[model samples]
Target: MNAATQYAISWKGLKNGTYHFDFKVDKALFQEFESTEIEDGDLNVSVTAERTEKELSLHVAIRGTVTVACDRCLEPYQQPVAFDGDLLIRFSDEEQEYDGEVLWLAPGETEASLAQYIYESIVLALPYQRVHPDGGCDPDMLSRFRIVSEEEFEAIEQEAEARHAQPLDNESLSRLTALRQRLEEEDGESEEKN
Candidate 1:
């Protein structure tokens, strides 16, 4: 089968039974998808798709190591990642929003590939703000960051204390308290809205 065909599976092929499939992702797969974030690595995926009369369930277990540039130093390093997730596929005549763990695929569709999902899972597993653990970083970079962070922290604390020390009347203090309450309310509202 062609690459596109290999990527998607037909729903008829997965009726009322459990099936296993595996794919090995290497440099070629990345190249095909034009993914520059991962230039070198190997990924293994074990997928179990089971159909129970009406609903289709897919469970995917992923394991792999990808080479990525260290955030502290521009040097390349390998990061290992593992993840498991389930997708539910419900046969539907019309496109519908599904809130469950499963993804819905239209009936008669052939071959489903989890390459993109696996890649995204691995990427999400990485730290949002990656910094080498304390002494584990490059000496020069760590030293510079330490000095900058300390200076910034001190400056911020001093500014906060200075603001808090300013004298105020009872009326002014009441207004300040009200303003603080309003700000806290706004913060909570924003979080809920998000």
Candidate 2:
């Protein structure tokens, strides 16, 4: 069976009520979609499907950890992921997408696969900047970037801050103030004309 087939839900003969399905999502499932951001993960996905007369609503809850490359160290590390989402499937004569949060099913459709939705929820739950906590990163990689003493580092930071905080000369400040006044006057004149 294909990857999507495993996640398909058949509503052909079922009555309108609530249903539950659980799946263990791993690297294989992600790779099926050619996902490159995440290489592997161990997550439990719980899907709750509630069918009513007008629509079918699905609640997706994903919780577990996934391995991602560190932005600074470039080493793979496990990152915890927790996400919750809702999908609304509406019946229509022809398949049509109302928006990102809603999907349309044809009148004769029998199955709906949730593999793509599950993948997107997991990926979106990850942090944009993937990095280990302080002192958790590889020491060897950090040493290559900065090996200075604590006092030396503090001194360098203070020096940089002082440079940024220095005030401009009086001549330059006066020139800037005059330029600002001129711009404001020009703006007022243009507004009056309009």
Candidate 3:
């Protein structure tokens, strides 16, 4: 089934009542969205849809793991995700904007797709710091990106200037220069804040 129909619910014929639905989420979802942050996933979505005279309410719950890049080391790792939320679908004669809490639907529409909601919920559930557990990053990659103390940064700067050294590759040197500029900007900002 197309992703549009895979997770859709046909509520046009349903009487005012409660219904349950299950949908499996996989790498196909991320592929459909062309997601850069989430590479792959194995997840289950359970939805309890309640139909009323005026509106439909869906309680969605998702659980599983997704493969994403580690923010620190840029290596792929599985991150567990769990999300629970309620979505309200209100029908109107005019098409309206969908706020995060409520979904506006045209009265003529027969089905509502949960694909976008499921994708967004999983993404939102991810941590701000998408990194592996302590000591989980690849040691080699960590070694490539080092954060130095202010004094150590100055010492490295002095040695490079004094020796006219080009010991590092272009990529390494670029990374070092960027890091140095960021450190200087941070220090300047802090001094201004004081």
Candidate 4:
């Protein structure tokens, strides 16, 4: 089902009273909104609503984990999510924008949609530095991004100048030496046979 219809609460049939709703959040909701930060998640959205003659007050709580890319290693990791906020829905005939705290719905509308609110709340709740726990990053990826000291960079630059080309690493240098030795041995053997 579309996220718009799935997360909506119908209130036209009810008299003034309090109501509760439980919703499960999965990949579909994020996919519907084309969320780039949140790749996937398993979350619960609990909403409690108090309806009166004028407006509906909603208390929203969300808790679970979402998959996101780690800033350090660039690998996907699970990040915990928790958000608690309140929203008020008021009936109006004129068009009004949702200001994160209040929602304006026409009196003729039967359902109050919570899809955009829920998605926005999750995005805002994410941490600025999204990453996995210490020592949990991929070693290989971390090594690729290792910081080079000034001395190491200077040595590399000098070596490059001496070689008049890009400096070769230890492994590459050893392989080149072994290949040269093998070629010399083959040349010696052929000369002896001749």
lDDT of 3 by residue, 1-194 (tens): 77779989888998999999999999999999999999999999999999999999999999999999987678999999999999998899987887778888899999988888999899999987777876678878866865334566777667666657556557756866986887887567556644
Task: Give the lDDT of residue 166 in candidate 4.
Answer: 59
User: Which is the better candidate, 3 or 4, if ranked by TM-score?
Assistant: 4
lDDT against the true structure, each candidate = 0.62, 0.78, 0.85, 0.84
lDDT per residue for candidate 2 within 1-194, as digits (tens), equals 66688878787776899999898888888789888889999999998989999888999899999999876566789999999999987789965765657767787889877778888889889987787765567778756754333344456445545667676556655755565565566456546644
Model 3 reaches what TM-score against the true structure?
Answer: 0.74
What is the alpha-carbon lDDT of model 2 when measured against the actual structure?
0.78
- Per-residue alpha-carbon lDDT of candidate 1 for residues 1-194, written as tens digits (9 for 90 to 100): 43344445456645588888787656665566676666677778787888788876888787887776666554566667687888777777777755545555666554444555655666666654444445455668545643233344455446555777675556755755565565566456546644
Give the clash total for candidate 3.
0
Candidates 2 and 4 compared: the better one by TM-score is 4
Worst 10 residues of 2 by lDDT: 145-154
Highest lDDT among the candidates is held by which one?
3
Best by TM-score, which number? Answer: 4
TM-score of each: 0.59, 0.72, 0.74, 0.75
List per-candidate RMSD values in Å.
9.2, 11.1, 8.6, 14.9
For residue 107, what is the lDDT in candidate 1?
63
